[model samples]
Target: MAMRASMHLVKSRTLLACAKEESEYRVRHPENSSPNARVLVLGGTGRVGGSTAIALSNLRPDLRIIVAGRNREKGASMVATLGGNSQFAEVDIENVKSLEAALKDVDLVVHAAGPFQQAERCTVLEAAIQTKTAYVDVCDDTTYSWRAKSFKDRAVAANIPAITTGGIYPGVSNVMAAELVRASRSESNGEPERLRFYYYTAGTGGAGPTILATSFLLLGEDVAAYNKGEMIKLKPYSGMLNIDFGKGIGKRDVYLLNLPEVRSVHEVLGIPTVSARFGTAPFFWNWGMEAMTSLLPAEFLRDRSKVQELVQLFDPVVRAVDRIAGERVSMRVDLECSDGRNAVGIFSHRRLSVCVGNATAAFALAVLEGSTQPGVWFPEEPEGIAIEAREVLLKRAAQGTINFVMNRPPWMVESDPKELGLGIYV
Candidate 1:
């Protein structure tokens, strides 16, 4: 009992220290705070975008928010929910003119319209660059993220900051890995060796057909993971492991996926062995995904139109399952060093629909606050997220998380922490 109490006290003190440091940093860097920023959210009618708009309003009520999308009724409805400081903009991402027109006056724009998979062009990003507007995206596709990064020189030339893969798992999760790697190096916690990302969500995470489509698209791509500084390709959803997400979420089976963070973290953080795995609830979903990879042609799965058709066919059934499974989301990041030191970071939220928005909004806020430099960068890149602002970013992203811990020992954050001897845990 005393040991548990001691551990709890340590955790509390750590969190309090982080909060204090962030608070003091904010006070010292008041220029980073933008109270009257005008933000535009593309795909504002969609689940992730709508949630991001709402979360942004909740975080900064004074900021002007423009919900931009094709459907006026849906956009207007979203605007109404956001109250007076918000309005709806008729914009189509496919039309560069529409995108540029909408982004012309906004201080920042969040591109949340995605299955980012199989996307050939960064249209909105190009428009943002053309208009010199600040940009952030909830992109989770590896190719798309790299494609966005290819525009770094142009974004710098335009004097605009852009972040790709800035959503929940790839977004906050990437940041979490960065924090872990940073701490491991700074504290001399052995030579950092392996970094693994494990994610579990219930149903479609309440994000609707878009997320379902993203999942289908992922199955079409080959998984890229790093091993001992070497890049390797493996079948998607092939390697499975059971991970304990601590409180609220227990142990769940996760499988390797072609997540963007695996590459970004490996490259940016310089981790030798890095991989990312994800799993969904009801168990059968896992089986079905694996089945799809085997039964369906890779080309069919990669085709966005075909994926959308599949989503339409399965949306109702998926929605019904989602209600029963609930919208719980948990991400566990593990880092192991050569000297047998293991550090873990976990973020668990009851509603992925809401948490994803909060997470994306956190990144958007960081960009708006000038924490990011004028270029396209991944979440782990220091230029993308200033080291000093990382704590604040994580705190904001984890606003409503049921369990959010960083830079803790694996035993401390594990659901079933093993006891060795004399109060020692491993």
Candidate 2:
């Protein structure tokens, strides 16, 4: 009885401390407390966008949500799922007038319309800047993300903040890397040497055709990775490594891809060697993806229209497989220091569809709360982007994660951690 009482007291104190911290955060950023903020989620008809809308509605029931897309039926369906505080907007991303009209009244816009690869213009972002509305995007393409960053000056001039690559893998993953690097430096762990990102997801990740198009597009690009302060390009999907993603997801084979977070992390976090790789389940899918790289011409793969056709052809099959494969997703970030010290961060969730929405909504909430400065920023940028609100952002993003750990030794988070005699694990 006495021990139980003591444990309850400890738990109460911990909750009090957390409440105090949250109070301080709210005091520091008053904009987040706005009661009547309106948010527009472009591409809300799609899987990623619809999920994001649901997540935002769940997180802040009072906020008004507008589901914007070209398909009125789909948009209306999504809005209906979001309850009374939500409505549908018929807007096409390619139509500047449509985008501008949609942005006029929204406090923030989430550009979840993607297959950002090979996109030549930042239409929605430009519209956001023109309307002086804050923005966030779930962009996974390297070229598009950098192009968004090029608008830093303009965004600052417009006095609106923007974040690119703010989705699950690139978004939350980038923040995770930053936190790991920050801890290493602050703790004098060692000079951070190598940073590797490994990701595993089940078939289609329950994200639908958009993700399929993105994958096909990525196959056309060469993989860019940093090695000892030098950049090198390798064939996409060539390098494969077996990574353990802890419980609920055992070891899986991941492959190299031209993901944006690698460059952003290497540059923003100043890591010497950085690379990102991803793989999906139902083993045949991995075989098929590698086969596509070899079978299809690079030009064919790079063509957006061609990729869409391919997505159309494969969508049914992928969706069928997704049912059996499930939508589990896991990301493991490993950082090795010069002095043989290693730190790791892992995020695993049962449903990629749900977790991605939460991850994106976390970034959206951060921007609404005044956590970002008036400029286009990457997730890893420390000054005024995500550093200040990282803890809260991570907490929100990790809401449904089955396994989430940070700043721990590799062994602690590994599925099959090796014991190296005595009490040491490696």
| Whole-model lDDT values for every prediction | 0.85, 0.84
* Model 1 ranges off by over 4 Å: 1-32, 414-426
Q: Compared with the true structure, what per-residue lDDT tens digits does model 2 show for residues 127-189?
A: 999988888999999999999999999987887878999999899999999999888888865
Q: Estimate each model's TM-score.
A: 0.90, 0.90
Model 1 accuracy (lDDT, Cα): 0.85
- Highest-lDDT candidate: 1
Candidate 2 Cα outliers beyond 4 Å, as residue runs: 1-24, 27-32, 415-426
Model 2 residue 167 lDDT? 93
TM-score of 2: 0.90
Tens-digit lDDT string for candidate 1 (1-426): 653343222112221123545534653563435556789999889999999999999987877899988899998899889999999999888988888888877778899988789888999999988987788999999999999999999987877788999999899999999999889888875888988899999999999989999999999999998888888888888777778998899899888899999988888888888888899999999999999999999999999899999999999999999989999999999998998888999999999999999999999888766567778999999888878878878888998899998888988765432222343111
